[model samples]
Structures are given as structure tokens and as C-alpha cells.
Target: MAGAMMLALADGGSFTLEWTHSVEREDWRETWEVTEDHRLHLTEAAVKGSGAGMEPGPGGHFEDGWWVWAPDLPPVPALTLAASGETPSAWTLCGEDCTQLGATSGQPVQVAPCPDAG
Candidate 1:
């Protein structure tokens, strides 16, 4: 299982969400940056062991009202979610096949692609 962390800017202008998984004594972290406009940016993704493999990827653009990050890595998969306003009343995390892996409501939002997702 993975754990999630969130940090909102002091001015409430930006926020970051991160997820971490432990592997071989190393922690792989996936992070997302949310701009004031509600645009989500993939700041860092991939394994964090030695802090060498983690590289920032071109984040997704705002579409409709959601921030969508397409799968760049095979196991990473893809992701989509609400971009603005208060925490979503409900949201879903889908796999590469678009299968729902998890869903939640009224909580700190933390989302990532399927595997090795950032």
C-alpha cells in the first residue's frame, strides 16, 4: 500500500500532493502541483531511490474542468480528475484499461497514474 501527503501554500494559491511507496528500502514518490487556476502539473514522478531516477515530465493541460495526465510510462498508466473548487464531492482513479482502482469524496485529493505513476 502507498501513503499520501498534501501541502497547501500559505496563500492558498498553490498546493502539492504526493504519494509514496517503499521498495527495497527506497521511497518512490509521485508528486503533483496544482496552480491557482486549478491546473495540475506533474512535477516529479518515478522511483526516488538515490534521488536519481526521478525526473519531471511535461504535465497535462487543462481540459474542460479536469486535469488529465496521460500515461507516459508503461506501468504508470494515466489519470484524470477535477481541477478546481473545493475538494471534489467524489472522484475516481482509473487504471490503464480505465478500470476504477479507487474512489473517494470530501478529502484531501491525491491522484497518480497506475504504476510508477507520478
Candidate 2:
């Protein structure tokens, strides 16, 4: 719960976060959805290339030029990301529209889901 943030989600809606590995120079992506209990659930993950320490998780397979898999993780109240301004590429968060998280460097960004108002 460090620096927690509460974000409202659309009913059964999902979001995507994409980033590039600093050393591997490959693209990584994760698809997350809001659970019924208003928590963040990681549904899928993909990597454009693999290297040392960049291998896909279990049950992963190459598809459409990317290694894709579903991460077997439990839903959580929030998700935290590192923002040390050290990575070669910045993080991109997309829902309705994609937005860069570059301005959040030097601190951590926490993402959580709030129950839909409807």
C-alpha cells in the first residue's frame, strides 16, 4: 500500500501497460482487468523478445512475434511500479487512450481500482 492510488474503472473494463526492457531492448506488455471486488487482476503478459532474465513465464508461447502468457497471480488491491528514470524507455498506460508515465519518475506509482459508480 505504498503511495496507494484509487482509480475508478468501467464495468468489466480492462487496461494495458506496456514498456521496453532496458537491457534486452524488447517490448513487454501486460493486460489487467478490474475484478468484481474492485481490485487489479493481471490477465496476460507478452514480451517481444527473450534474453537472460527476460524469459516468459510458465505456459508461455510465441505468437504473432511475441511471447504471450497468462500470469498465474492473485488479484491485489493495488499495483506499484518503479519510476527511477533509469530505463531507456518509459512506461505507457492505456485504457481509453495511451499515456506515458515519464513524469512520475523518482517516485513509485500505485494503481488500484475503485468500484464503478453505476
Candidate 3:
């Protein structure tokens, strides 16, 4: 399985993130919106399997500048976002087993193609 988080600067100084995971020939995507106050909102979630479901709750927050999102789903990667100079710009997707799928450093984010993806 592989996972990644794409970050972009939204209008009004907020941010938008799209977290995606590919496993078992299926893809799971979670869309989020971060406010200027650092509050995260789970705007939408979709999965190829009917067994997969996400519960929206207190979502996430920025800790010292890095945005952290920890959900109750197993095997789902954790999302973290950090800034380079002033704004939150970089992100990392860490699997539950501690495997890091991808990360970014200020430029356009890209998920390293997973050889095992299917």
C-alpha cells in the first residue's frame, strides 16, 4: 500500500489538503480544509470499498506550526504538514506501521510511485 498528502495554499490564507491511499486495487481519498486558526475540517471522504467509512469529529490542529491529523482508522497513514518560512507548505504521509510513503519540501508535492501498488 502507498499513501500521500497534497497540500496547497487556499484563498483567504487558509489551506487545502488531499490525502490519498492506494491498497488492494482500491483508492481512498480524504479531503480536508484548514482554517487560519489552524482548525481542520474533514470536508469529504471516499473509498472504493463499502467496508471503509470515516467518522468526522474533532479532526486536527496545528502543533507549533505542523498540522497533524490522527484518525481512528487502522493502517491509514497519519498526515503532517509543516512550513518552510512562514506558511505551512510541506507534508508527509506516515503509515500506521511506521512506513513513510512520501513527503514534500516547499515545491510541488509528488508521491513516489509505489511499485507494489495495484
The model with the greatest lDDT is 2
lDDT of 1 by residue, 17-115 (tens): 322322233333344443434344454344333333333235744444333344354322224443333332223222222222224332344443222
Which residue pairs clash within candidate 3?
A: none
The C-alpha stretches of model 2 lying farther than 4 A from their native spots are 1-7, 116-118
Task: Assess each prediction's global lDDT (C-alpha) against the native.
Answer: 0.35, 0.82, 0.36
| lDDT tens digits, residue span 1-118, model 3 | 1433433333222223433332233334455444344344445444443323332224644444333444543321224433333332223233222222224334333422222322
> Per-residue lDDT for 47-102 in model 2, tens only?
99999778999999999999999999998888877787888777888988777775
Which sequence of candidate numbers ranks them by TM-score, best first?
2, 3, 1
- Cα displacement (angstroms), candidate 1, residue 75, comes to 19
Better of 2 and 3 by TM-score: 2
Evaluate model 1: give its lDDT. 0.35
Instruction: For candidate 2, list the clashing residue pairs, or say none.
Output: none
Provide the RMSD of all predictions against the true structure, rounded to 1 decimal: 15.7, 3.1, 16.0
- Least accurate 10 contiguous residues by lDDT in model 1: 93-102
- TM-scores for every predicted model: 0.26, 0.84, 0.31
